[model samples]
Target: MYSPNFYSFVDRAKSDENGFIEFHNAYVSSKMTNSDLYFVLNRYGLDEEQKDFHIKISPSKTIQPKDKQVGELLEQRLSFEKNIPKAITLNDNIKPNIKVNAIEYIPQEYNHNSFNSPSEHHLIESITLQAHYVLKDSHKKNIQGDEQSLLKESIQRHKHKTKWGYIVFDRDEDIEQTLKQLNKTQPLIYSKRFKELENIKGEIVNIPFKEEWENKQIRFFAYLWRANRDVGWNYEYTIEKLRMELNHLTESAYAIFAKEFIRIPQLREEYQKTIKQISNEILAIVDEEKDKSKKFELAKQYSKEAYLLRNQVLNDIRDKSSEFARALAKSEKPILPSFESLIARKMQQNNFMGKFENLSLEQKTKVYRDIIDSSKNTRKSVNNKMIYYKVFGRTFAIATIAYVSYDIYYSDDRLKTAREHTNIIGFGLLGSSVGMAMAVDTCDINPICYAGFALLGSLVGSSVGNLINNATDTILKKYGYE
Candidate 1:
């Protein structure tokens, strides 16, 4: 007779709170279905124990007769005949209590074209059960009595709760034929088992089970299953999470640097203060150190940290500078001169040797040279041709207008002659507009340079046109048309 306590234990094991049933089902499927249990038992010297246990655990009359027959059929299908010659023989010690009312093993049906070509054989290779089982007193005693009790306990407690338990069978001509016969009679049961086994391997092993197996087998299985599951899930999750966090950090860094760009001089001053603090700390450490090796190590550490901080600050500055450039490109604002350039220009405006200045001539000259070099590099980096063409177009347009105005002022016949010249100048202006439009598409230049050059070109062209008109009028008055 089956023990009620054993059934209760199995119920608890299979309960939703603890997924013991799922785990045990997975264990049995992996070992029995794959028939790797024999090899595992042999390798770990549990062959005799496994054989004894297998006989004892065989489904009795207490289990449904149909269930027992199904279990037997699954076992037969999974058994390694070459390795275990006695696999087919029923052990006389353990009498089969359950009557075999009817036996059926069906393969799940699949659409051939869904996975492969219609001509290709689409074989249903495995069946799985989602089941719950209770631990027998003997099983619990075996687990507790084992030398590796901790490993046993961990496996029993943690294995197979969520998304656990699967059984797979190797395909054979006989098995396929049997499945075909079964499928004709009961399609629902066969389809259910097929769906249960599909893409289920590691999850089944994670479900907890009755700790009746040897300690070594339990440990090996538990460790292998956990490692496989972690590889599939945990490790990838960790790396992906870290990558996402790093991307977020990069965005935060940009935001901080953007704030610094708007208040650059203030940020530069703050950076100087940080550098001073670092230097002071290094000096204090150097003074306190007695041992040469220790001092060298400490100094090196300080220097490395300081260098890293400086590099971070520099990168922040670069990011902010790029942001500023982008903003200026869009705004077409007057390029505010660089801090050093502005200071130098102010000094030059006051005269290098001015009585009002505190800075020495040598200091002023050095500052001026640095500003000049910076300005030169900045200009070199800009697209000069684009700037030049933009300025030239605007200047030519203004010159066309001034020339027409001159024709009005100096014409012998006032309205008629002026109108005719105005028409000529209007054509020139239209040509200039087309040239400027073409120039705009030629390159991506700094917007500040574009605006500056355009304004400068117009002023210069207007001055030249005025000078030309005055000279023409003076010469014309000396001759005739005036």
Candidate 2:
């Protein structure tokens, strides 16, 4: 379970004239303190320099009244966390007691080490911030006041404002109950979550993001949120949707980066490793799953992911090989990387697939089988190519010899005595070479069959060549040369 660095939610933040940061009702990750959060924010390009930040959240203030009784009841029922609106704020100044240090952000797990350039780094940071903030809002409990009428009023107002969307519950029973309470047409969904379901309390949140963000962006963040939390998402239903989105994003990112910037070697290696690790994890799950349909779907998903990863890796290798060649050419003591060396580097990529020793016997067997099959296919391809090359070379050589022999034998009457014999031998050799090439491709690997075909072709060619030579000699003799 490789987890990426989780980001804290800064609902709103601003900078003061004195060059200090103000964080308002922000949610920090459990592992990170305020000082640590500050450092991370700066590192990710979201800091005091940005001047102001805002993320739209739920329970529109205008919809709720200022009734003191309702407010008091809400405060009593909800704790400090539940009472506060989804709004976030930052204080103008850091607390005097809290010491801020310049600490580096080291990821606890490898999520995406491919982001090496400043621009790529910024993109990942932005994605993390967006996903976390949106998720925070989606998980918050809807503020149902003490009175039933107030709750009805709020629901009515919200319902009129936005389209009704599906709700996802953490437990299976919860899903069934919710589905019965609402429309049966609403689908149940599930996905692999990092956290345990028993430890954390789950709430029914309204369609959190669709109303606020663009459809494409909404779906993107939705996938991210579903992936991290321990909830059942209908994998079969969303497999195509999610897989296509991933492909689109991966290809789009690769295209933009390849065109706009030079790749960093370390980043490319990490990216390649990350994809492999993810694919291996998926394969492990597929092996564990007993349900046939789910297993098949998972297999398909894995294949698609692996295919894309392979293509990206091959493209990277090709570009790097060209680059390495160019760089070596420019150097005073230049030496090009060999084909074997390139292949060794490729094989080294599997090192990043994480621990494979822990796999069950069945999984290990399956993996080894796949490797063997792949090797066999590669060998077959190489053998076929070599066969073609050899056949072409032999045919070319034999044809050249036959043509040259005929030209020389006919160029002067001095060799006319042996012209017929030479022609027969040369044509027989050419025919035999062609026959051998044809037999190799069409026949079973039998030496006797090849020899029989070669002999038959040689006999036919000799007869034709001898006839032509004799006819020419007769004509020349009649013309008085003989």
Candidate 3:
């Protein structure tokens, strides 16, 4: 799913004398997973139709494209071949009589998770399905009048015609335009809207069994659509929230660390100013570099320098003032849950030294390194949990709210339900932002503290909204208003 986006084309060429359509400088990229390529190919009929062809994709020495092609195509072929680790051969003899329904064409990955359900990761991006419409028999056949052979032929050919259609349920805004285009060709139908396809007499044949199955499939698809939207919304929300909180935490910690720990009053003002100057220099380097990889490397280098400067400053402060050293040492206690296992090891080694002056320079260095490592580990763990909650937890909550709203507000009064849901969510978000702003200064290096405060504020805001809604309902009932 994280594969780099690149443009590739299948060039058509005639088969050689050996009945082989040999491609030059062409291969499936190793960067592309089998499921990835399968998803792309499945849309164009990988499992639905029969084909009399064999595909052989084997590794070979570097082969050039057509001699005259000088610009982009030549470059692309070279890039493609360079990235390809291995290639696979596909040979199939599909039966003409075999018919695969739209819902049956599931990729290999789905098998591991569920029969037809997509993985959470795939759902986060988009849910693309090759959907089909039920094109019913236009003319009803007289079964009693037809002979046995005629009946068989009519059954095979007259019941329905398979019309292959392409559909993409993209999570992007482009989906609106895509739906519009699809609507021009065939009216987009919702499963909940059409209870029975047979109601459209003359077009739909009365087949109760098939109709029931199709209804189930339709409901499943509708569920997938709802899940897809919920996942996308939660993913974006959590990522934005994480980024904002991280930035706030980093700035706060840096300000506190620089002003309190790094700066030495005894040193010259100019000298003190240069102690934390590398952070600014690293930002400048990042801004100057256009290439992402190079920028990352430069930032990495500066981070190492920053760490050494921190250690040097801590040592200097320790040697000058034991009082300041003790204070700084106390701050290194297990501030985060991630530090427990790490600090436990150190505690056993040093017998949990009470006095900072008693510990050697090596001990101090180890403690500082442990705290840094724990902070990094905490950040990673928190980010993953944040993603999980954003995808599943928030989605569940929203779905529940929506369902409750739907139940409370009858179909005739859906506008009220929509308004109430919007108001509640809006209030919660507004409260969250205000809470974050108020608590950012109090937040320490641990990100969990800030997240907790934000969650508390959101809960309070939602509760207030619910109470207001109940009060309004009571007033309305008291006045005999609908």
Candidate 4:
């Protein structure tokens, strides 16, 4: 298991020289070092590129804050998406850092508004927030003496405070418990973790990603936190706060990442043989390319082509994901990701479901990659497209080939007149070409598979020849022209 721990707490951060809001009192537990939780959350955090802002404006423009354009600037910086946040900092990699500029609301007199905005307490210009990527650093435990000072400072700063507005994330109670139970049983292969995963996999196999399973997910993470309780987070500080924050944004991709990321370690032993074999094949091919300059040039061309294709694929993925996220955020009713279509693709690709008992950790990893990388077009759209070519293009070619092959091979056979041959060829058996259609459809198998088309053509030609022979016999007797 990857077994990375996660911990989150809200607190006031220090302002740097540039005066960006930096949270120091995350109060992360001792065992779960700042690095693990930091990297995991940052790995699955709301990416800057996916962050869309919903700005709140007040009508009382008269009593504005000192920084008039600051609010506008904040919106400009935060609202407009940037590239995906980087996971590692240069040289020093203790904790993954996000470079975001966040504004802590120092609220003053609140202006009230009722139209358009759901927020009743109008955000008076007194509170201005700056925007930057959030950065994570070393653990800063909130000391006992600091609590009172911090509270006093908060009240003093926002003396005329208006309303409490913070993003609250919640997950269901049952789900949290289930995750806890599974985390407890994670050590053994036949333990409850496997069972719970199966349950979740089944439950989320359809549309309307249900609430019950989401709760399970929450419980899973919560318990995963507790799994390292002795070394990481203890029950005293985190569990209650975790339980309180029940309504988390469920649609995000973090949980899926966490679940799949853990399975990576599980695949190491199972795939050793395959990896070694692939390495040997690669070495052999490279060794065969003895001409140094020629090999270098050929390799350079392939590398350049691969790089171009990768860029195009990544760009398309980002565009689609961004579009889907925006639409889902605006959706009236939201749910977890069912990912059924992705799961079906994985199952079909690896044939994972064919023999559940035979599945090893490596095969499981392959299946997981299939689902996770579906957006990246990991599998080709071959079979789904083959039928179309068969119907439209190959079917016509079947009959034409049959005529030419039969004429070339069997010109000595009894066919007296050109009219008779034409008449015979006119009645082509379109339906009898299914075998040829299937063969051409599976051209990936081998070129010989296309010989089915030849057989189809020959059958057609033979039928035409018989019709011509019989028809000529009838016409000669009836019209005396033959």
Q: Write the per-residue lDDT of candidate 3 for residues 137-211, one digit (tens) a residue.
A: 332243345354543443233223222222223234354454455445444443223232322221122222231
lDDT per residue (tens digit) for residues 1-482 in model 4: 01122222234344469645433333323432222112112333232221111011101112123333322213111222233233212112232222222223211222212111122231112223222222223212533456545444333222221111111124333433443564574642234343222221110011112333332222111111012211111111122222222112111112112211222221221122223333344334434676765544443343333334333433332232222222222242233334444445566776667653366655544444333333223213432333443343323433343454466456664445344444444332221233334554444334244344434543665476576679678978798765
Q: lDDT of each structure?
A: 0.35, 0.36, 0.36, 0.31
Error of 4 at 261 (Å): 42
Ranking 1 against 2 by TM-score, winner: 2
Candidate 2 structure quality by residue, lDDT tens digits, 1-482: 00012333345444468545443333323342222222222322222222222111122212122332232212111112331222223321211111111111222223443422231221121111111112123223553455445433333222111111123333223443544444344322332212122222112222212222222211111221222212223212222232223212221112112211222333334444555555566567767878755655565455445545544543444344222222321242234334334333333444424345564444443443243222212224433444544444334433444554566666765477356555675566555545655675554445456556666666766677688888888998999988
What are the per-residue Cα lDDT tens digits for candidate 1 across 234-273?
Answer: 1112222222232121111122222222233323333444
lDDT of 3: 0.36
lDDT of 4: 0.31
Q: How accurate is candidate 1 locally (lDDT)?
A: 0.35
Q: Which stretches of candidate 3 lie over 4 Å from their true place?
A: 1-407, 410-414, 445-448, 459-482
Local lDDT at 254 for model 2:
23
TM-scores for every candidate against the unseen true structure: 0.17, 0.21, 0.25, 0.17
Better of 2 and 4 by lDDT: 2
Off by over 4 Å in 4: 1-431, 434-461
Candidate 3 TM-score over all chains jointly: 0.25
